[model samples]
Target chain A: MSGVRVLVGTRKGAFVLASDGKRERWDVTGPHFGGWEIFHLKASPADPNRVYASQGTSWFGQLIQRSDDGGKTWEPVGNKFVYDGVPGTHLWYDGTPHPWEFARVWHLEPSPTDPDTVYAGVEDAALFRTTDGGQTWHELPGLRTHESASSWAPGAGGMCLHTILQDPSRSERLFVAISSAGTFRTDDAGKSWRPVNRGLRSEQIPNPTAEVGHCVHRIAMHPSRPGVLFMQKHWDVMRSDDAGESWQEVSGNLPSDFGFPIDVHAHEPDTIYVVPIKSDSEHYPPEGKLRLYRSRTGGHEWEALTNGLPQRDCYVNVLRDAMAVDALDPCGVYFGTTGGQVYASADGGDRWTPIVRDLPAVLSVEVQALP
Target chain B: MIRVVLPAHLRKLAHVDGEVTLDVEGLVTQRSLLDALEARYPMLRGTIRDHVSQQRRPFVRFFACEQDVSHDAPDAPLPAAVATGDEPFLVVGAMAGG
Candidate 1:
């Protein structure tokens, strides 16, 4: 009952880490999706037995694979996000698009209220909401075919929706971040949307537009208090006290303003974690030092937590979906790097330890504390 | 033009080892440089650009100076320095996911 299962996704495949829960010794498993890059992996909070993975091959395209019995045997879901000849019609293409046109699923969030309900953000600048698990999906037309979509540009990964924050309290209320397209929030489900880019910077336009392109990398919300949110922006890390209406840069004491991912504690409303990278220069942690900054008062003040991290010049980059927190008593925090290393802190971000290192370029990480 | 630093994976596929220098003729579009790169490396032909459409591969990325050149047109000419041999054309295996 105390073992915490850590799932590490990589460019090559996915690995499962089983820990002893104390002085934790993690056991690694699989290249799971078999060479296809696993962009996102999640273990359902409602049922830890159910695991979902988003994978794509350079030559094969994208597919969603689910594992019902942990990481043992896997099966591809019947419904796919394939694009056929029809423009407006939502079809699941088998990855035969032009070589440059590759649709990758970046993030997957199983609805907090319903395990059967799921949402995924794709690289083609669209969001797919699936009910009855991954069996079928309907493109959230509001975010997918929005009017301002024509003006929204992709970041390094191509124009796509990266983060979708579903309100834990009111499932209908949601927040979505479109890379280079700014952020959007929907009060009445996905029927309509509005721009929440106030106080954010967008270099693509001479003056920042009201609706999009602030290069938002990741967004996280306080599970209990849905309105309070935190974002790791391309230029700044911010906090939205009033349900993302406005934001203020809270990276006052952080190492770097530019970072890819930020996470709030699953249980603590004020506690948050961020992997700070040198924002203005080439994306890497400051001085090659991997420091996880934690804020006790909702990013107002920060402290560097580096107990078991590398004490040398370690220049590795952590992507948007890499760092995440597991549902545990102390709340386990984990992150993987471009250098093929995975670091976990069972006691939140206070003390850090490497679960696995020097494997392959890690793409994403998900931890599920076993029930 | 923009100098691209090739990652080890692409360098090995292209053979010749290290960062192979190339002078791209005309515009330095992703397709043009990849075409030039494939022509010289031979082994790297389908590695960077698709064998059929000759488009850039999904996993392979083109970066010069500090910007991503993957989305750029294949026919568009690259920067003058890159075309002249001032900087190395980087063929990178984009690090994604985690």
Candidate 2:
């Protein structure tokens, strides 16, 4: 029998929500690593039993947690993340030279074929890889040493390398997105990188179409169609057909395209989803109604899916990493909100239900479809 | 035996119910005590201080016998009561962030 295990990271600790393929009832476990901020949790595709978590605190620093038997038990692996070389400086919000610092791991991308190999995207904007599971980490310096890195500035959320996309068809190609500093692509694994923000326009920056200063909230791509990328920027929904060589606005009919999370249907390559928040300043839903807008044509045309979602008096924000999808037949979409609700739609986006009503403010949600 | 009390979160991480007792081989100072503590509970490394710089974390503090010893040098000797196990050396999370 197939099942789904939703790994949820929250402001305080982590939780594991499990259910059979029916996706009806769920068993919730944890508050694991209690009082600690779990920024991201993901299971390896190479091994369903292998899972990794990024746990950290402002006072105590970062810690990596790994589990061999899913999320049932986790042990702290490695907490050290040091930059290579002298660690050059990047531009501060004030355009002054600021030294790069290790803040926290924002996302963890495990290898598709090796459970022991994992990649971590972290704040101060850098990528680190651990080939020996999570036991050690070494910085991939090329991304940070790009020619324009000196001008890269931090966004409101601090300069974080939040999004990482590995090309399923090509092992050498990888894409990463940073706040304020646009998207970057590495065709030679981690040895080299280049800015891929050719058509992304950000009014917030001095130069609206600068090569590397867009506040891209999230980016998603279906594994089968690795070249087609969809992004939810600070103000627009975008699509790239040429693997991010260029992008175009796809904010067709969304009430507001200024949202965080954006994900694609597991089985439908042309189907995508976004939770449109009011605006960057106003982090709540437009009209105080929670609605998930879906695009069947990839973008430009969208429909609102709000059957079981709150229609009024609800004002929670969905973060960039809070939404995910399971690779089941009918396809299941899940997302968590700042108001501490984890909503699951077993049948695509037609209807929704809360798997866990209250938890710590959710930071990220990832799902593992197990056999 | 030197008695040390970790912050609530660190205690849960180390899986200790209350204060932890450690045997400091040499001088009883912040540096030596922490060395012993981390040697015993490896998971506590980098929590109280930087893993490389060894500088105390900005939001973490130290106190012994009700006196704030956070500003003391790492090599400075702790109070007699703390060294004698009569008083526990406290690692506190500063009252910051809501």
Instruction: Give all candidates' CA lDDT scores.
Output: 0.75, 0.94
lDDT of 2: 0.94
Q: Candidate 1's residue-wise lDDT over A289-363, tens digit each?
A: 888899988885899888998756988999988988877778889999999999988888888888888767888
- In candidate 1, how many clashes are counted? 20
Off by over 4 Å in 2: none
Q: Model 2, A351: alpha-carbon shift in Å? A: 0.7
Alpha carbon lDDT at A159, candidate 1: 64
DockQ of every candidate structure: 0.05, 0.77
Model 2: colliding residue pairs:
none
Q: Which CAPRI category fits model 1?
A: incorrect
Could you tell me the interface RMSD of model 1?
9.0
Q: Estimate each model's TM-score.
A: 0.75, 0.98
Give candidate 2's error at residue A299 in angstroms: 0.4
TM-score of 1: 0.75
Residue A347, model 1: Cα distance from true site in angstroms: 1.7
Q: Which prediction has the highest DockQ against the true structure?
A: 2
lDDT of 2 by residue, B13-72 (tens): 888989999999878999999999999999888889998889999999999999999999
For model 1 the local lDDT of residue A204 reads 49
